[model samples]
Every structure is written in C-alpha cells, then in structure tokens.
Target: MRGRFARAARLAALLVLAGTVQAAPVHASEVAHPFTVLGTPDRRDVVTWGASADRTGDAVADRSYRLVVHTSVGGGDLRIRLSNAFGDRPVTFDSVYAGLRRDGAELVHGSNRPLTFSGARSVVVPAGGVALSDPLPGRLPAATDLVISIHTPDAAGPATGHWMAMQTSYATQGDHTAQESAGAWTETTGSWTYLDAVSVRPPTGTAAVVALGDSITDGWQSTSDLDRRWPDYLARRLSTAHTRVKGVANEGISGNKVLADGAGQSALNRLRRDVLSQPGVRTVFLFEGVNDIKAHTGVTAQDLIAGYREIAQRVHAAGKCVVASTVAPFKGWSEWDPAGEAVRQEVNTYLRGSGDFDAVTDFDHILRSPYDPERMLPFFDGGDHIHPNDKGMQAMADAVDLSRLDCAGRR
Candidate 1:
C-alpha cells in the first residue's frame, strides 16, 4: 500500500510540472491575430474609381477627376488604389488630393488634402502597373460624403475601365485650386474612371467579396473610367445594406477561359492565384464558361458543365461560398455558331437547375432581351451583343439576394 501511494504521488508531481510548462506565457509573435472580416452596412454609399488614359500623340488637357464617397462610418483612414493595368506607356500623376465636397458640387476650396505614394507626392506607374496609397487622414462620419481628386500634367492614354461594381465616381478638368469653378470650363478634358475595389480597415468580422469571371466579368466595354459593371452594382447594393463586408475584388481576366488557355490562363488554373489567394475572400461569385463554348468547336455542353462542377468543388473545399452566375446572352458573335448556342443552353440549364452551387445568380435572365429571346436587350448591349451597359450591369447586381450570404463569415 505504501509503495503504491508513493508511485501515485510521483506521477502526480510529474503531471503538475508538465502543466506548468505548458501554461508558460507565449510571445505575441507566436500567437496569430484571428482574422475577422466585418461588413460595412452604413457605408454602402461609398465607392472608388481609377483613371488610365491613352495618349496616342496629342497634348490633350491633363486628366483629372474627383471621387465622392458617402460614408456613415467615422474616424477611419481612407486608402486609394491607382492602376495602369492596360496602358501602353508609363503614366505619371502630378498630384492627388482628398477633400470635402462643397454643397455637393465640387471639392471644397480650402479642404484639399494632398496624397502620396511611398511618401512621394507623385507616382509614375508603368504600363500594366498598380500602386496603393498610404493611409490618409480623413474622418468620414455616417451620411457624410468625401471626395478624392487626382490631377495629371500630361495627356492620358486611351483607357478602359472596370465598371459594374463601383457605386459612384466623377471626372473633371483643371487643378485642385480651380476645382470650385465647376461651370467655368468649356469642355471636360481629363477622365475619371470608377473601379471595383478600395482598401478599408473595417471593424472586426468583415470579409471581402470576389467577383470571378472572364472579360464580361472584367468590365470589357462599359466605357473607360466608369464603374458601371454588374459587380459594381452589387457592391453598391451590399454597401447600402450597411453590412460589415469589406469590399469587392475584381478577379476577372480579359479573354480568360474556363477549361482551356488563352489570354491569361484557364479559370481553373488561376483559381488558386486569383480567388483563393486574395485576402479576406469569404465569398466567390463565378461567371465563366462562355468563352469555353465559343472557343472549342467540338466540345459539348456536358464538358462545360463538368468544368463548372470541378471549379465549384474546389471552392467548397476551401470552405468558401460559391455563387454561380449564368453566362450572359451572346447571340451576335461571328464565332457564336448555332451548335455553341445549344451547348450554352444546356450549360445554363444545369447551372440554374443543378444543386452544384451554394447559390445561383441568373445573369442570363437579366441581360437577355424580352422581345428577342436569343439576343440581348437593345439598350443594354454595348454594340458587341455580349457585355452589358452600365444600366444592364446594375440590373444584374440588383437581381442578387444579398441576404443569402453571411456577412460575418468573410475573414
């Protein structure tokens, strides 16, 4: 009995020592900050824009514009993203400013705040380049609107915009000092384009949205500098709802395909790099496969359906919600053969009917003309019979049921 008691006591002491070692204080670096993405329900009226000009050979007026954001949240710093993602030459900016709007017309005369990139007042972004601004000192409260003004000293090149997800943006000419003179200019010189994204350090539990698609998803033809794409519309809707979601990430690559390689690469090939790899990506809205049907002459609808299923499975495995969007109408393409239409119908039918996705967004129904079932709505078509106009994109975003997503699950 004595021997057994002694052995038990020894084991108890050993266990207690192990517990003490395990309870030792851990360094902060050893502990990771639990990432949480919060939805911004009140700042739904806020949006962002980008400008990229194509200077073919003329000394056109300097391209300049202002961004107005109606925010309900206060005390947070504002950040901007500028890009030359498709420019042919290096683009330089003379100055950038952020200020309050005077009577909702233009930037307040004395309220202009200079912006910088890496502590420098100017940035020279090369062709296919991007830059993120340092955090600015702007305290925007709920219901108040803020404006961002950018000025360039030289002519801007021919620029294409990523529309559909930006809420609102404005373009104007002249420098910041002359911003108050709204009606003084003979004609608008420079251009301002709205984009699908902005950087925000939202409160805890906010997640960002990823709009994954092809050229149509990338906002191919809605006009340079106008945020008139369907995803931009969806971003506006989500913001208006005051959900704490972060912002939308435009993952669309022009000429991208679903199964085969083309402009960038196959959608499946880039999924990890584009969708799964982005920060705060809680939800992925996919609208691809039209190019696949158009590119391959012998491929069947079943092949496209299988490709979609594979993509969905990969997204689900990542523990994110996959919202499948049907391909928009594309009846007038020179390569849009009759056989391709049959495949399109079959693929869309499966997308609408199959339970393969967490939810389905019907882009086909929104862009298709009611009068002509095979063609797109006349006003919505961008003369290409594929991509939607600003208004058409807005309608597509409006069709989504925002409540189907969990705003708290984004991080």
Candidate 2:
C-alpha cells in the first residue's frame, strides 16, 4: 500500500509540471511584433506633387504662407518636404499644418492636421538642405486642393521657393498656421514658398512619372488654378487607367535648359534632386531642349544629342526608363531662325531614330502643323507660339502611351 501511494504522488507531480509548461509565457525578445512581421516591407511612398525649388529673393522674418497644391494620387500618411536649398543660412519652421481647402485660404472643417518632425513640433533646415515632415495620419484624396500653412519665426537670407506657381496662395503675419479660416489670411501671392514636394504612401506596386521639361510642362500658358498643365492632364488619365503608375510630378522650370542653368538648374544638375530623388519613380519623361536650341548659344544637334544621351544613361543607371519627346516647332517666336530650326530638326530626327531612349513621344508631330512642319498649329499655340494652351496641353498628355509609363520589370 505504501509503494502504491508513492507512485500516485509521483504521477501527480508530473501532471503539474506538464500544466506549467503548457501555460508558459513567451519571452518578449523571442517573439516578433505583428506589425514588424507584416507592415513595412510592402509599403512604399510616392510623390503626389512636386515643384523644383530656386532662389525666391523674398525672404522675411515672422511671416506665414498658406500655399495651395494639387495632389495626383490619393493615399494615407501624407508628408511635405520644405526646402532651404537656396538659402544662405539655416531656417527654422516653428509651425506647419496641412488641410483640405474649403475655398481660398480656408480649410475644410475637421481636416486640418499638424505635422511633426521626429516627434518634435519644429525642425531646423540648414542652408542648401531639405526637411521632410513626419507622415500625417488619414487618407488624402487625389486631384484635391491641399493647403499647407507654414510659419518661420526667424526667416532670413535667400528664401528657397518656386517662383512661378501659377496658383493663387495667401499669406499673413505671425503664427496663424493653426487657423482654419481665411479671416487671418488677408494677403495674396502667386508663387509657392518654402514647400517643394508632397508625398503619400499608396498600395504596393504603385509608381510615379516625372516630366522634365521647360515652361510648357510648367503650365506657363495654361489657365491658373485650373490644373491644366500637360502633366496634370496626364495624372488624371493615369488615375482611371489600368496601369499602376498613377503618380505624376512636374519638375519643369520656366526657361529651364537641358544643357545649362539659368531658370533653375540644368536638367543634368537638378536631375538628382528633382527627378531621381522622387520616390517610386518608374520613368523620366524627357520633353526639353527647345530653350537650348532657341537660345542660339552655339549648341549644335550633336551637342543636344549628347546631352540627351547623358540624361538617358543617368536615368537608366538609376533603374528608371526615359521617354524622350521631340522638340515641338516654335517658328513664330522671336528667337526662331533658320539655324535654330535646322538644329531642332536634326535633334528631333535623332530622338526619333535613336534607341538610346526607352521610348519616344512625338510632341513635334502632335503640336506642329502639317501645313508647315516648322510652325506650331495655330489652334494649339498659346499666343507666344512656344507655349501651348490648355487644348494643346491635353493633346500632349493624350499622346503618351499609358503602357510606356509603366516601366515595371523593364528596368
């Protein structure tokens, strides 16, 4: 009987040990968080809107700007990038906010949200540097007006901005970035200040296209506040199309050149910041060279071709495709001459025949008249004979093959 009792006690002790093992908690270090396992790897940020930054020469202290921008793709977690790229000293932004526009200088109710930087309310950007804001929560709709208000407490030196925004924005004094009404935003401006680019995270596999060109791509002749630029129209088309490349960024600068810097930076010099730095860009739409050709700076067809090839090589090295556009005819412009026209023709010929570019869009054919191949079609000309009107802009956007913009796996 004694032996039986001892065996039963031993069995009970073994049962208790088994229960303890089954109920053991996992060590915090041994198990991975669910978010770490399933969140970051598939998510990517794409540029929804961007403008090339240059010296504005309008620096001031204790000023606020209510800049309006248009988005190309809708997604959650919106972020904005401010530039001190042309400044001579560091600039501190004490307050910044993003909201949907209810009207001029007014924000949509309950939509305005504050943007933080590394969990701080302020960020200091050094000269020739850029600061990207921490992502704001919630989804931003595509093709909507996003109002960004910023205040610099000690803004001085050369201000960095896009001088020709073509969109009407507002400004005022003191810290009014937290205001959602237009009551305090009394002053008006035509350019976007400080803010250079905006981005958002879309679904995996989504991508973007950057249009690198001159005033035409910059919406020079298009109606202001109408979003009538060729790139804007292209963004609208991409939104409903089956292609995954929906994001569009216009990197065009007025009077910009492909070979030299005057308006902003040359295509070669600014390519890294304006084009390559944009996230999830699958293609670089090359539609420049008219300024270089017409300037009569002794740029030959060979020289222009070399520039194009260099741009193509650099873009390819970055694992992106290049879609070259033939320089459109501009005969009526004051700079038009037989010498420049001849160079333009030769360059177009090379752009058409050369396999250096991944694809080609014949903008010359689209905008030039069949009656006289050297001049723009009167219907599309924007009075200047160089820049195109809204109709012409839409036509240019329509000419792009949607499939070519989707350079997935074609790198």
Say which candidate scores most in lDDT: 2
Give the C-alpha lDDT of model 1.
Answer: 0.58
lDDT of 2 at 39: 11
Model 2 weakest 10-residue run by lDDT: 14-23
The residue-by-residue lDDT of candidate 1 on 232-286, one tens digit each, is 6676777667665535666676667787765654677656534554444567788
Q: Report residue 218 deviation for candidate 2 (angstroms).
A: 0.2
lDDT score, candidate 2: 0.83
Write the residue-wise lDDT of candidate 2 on 1-411 in tens digits.
Answer: 222222222221101000101111222321321000101211378999999888888699999999999999877677788888788888999999888888899887766667776566787877766776776656777888989999999999899999898899999999999998999999999888999888888888889999998999999999999999999999999999999998999999999999888998788777776777777788999999999999989999999899899889888877889899999999999999999999999999999999998889999999999999999999999999999999999999999999988767776
* lDDT agreement with native, every candidate: 0.58, 0.83
- Model 2, residue 13: displacement in angstroms? 53
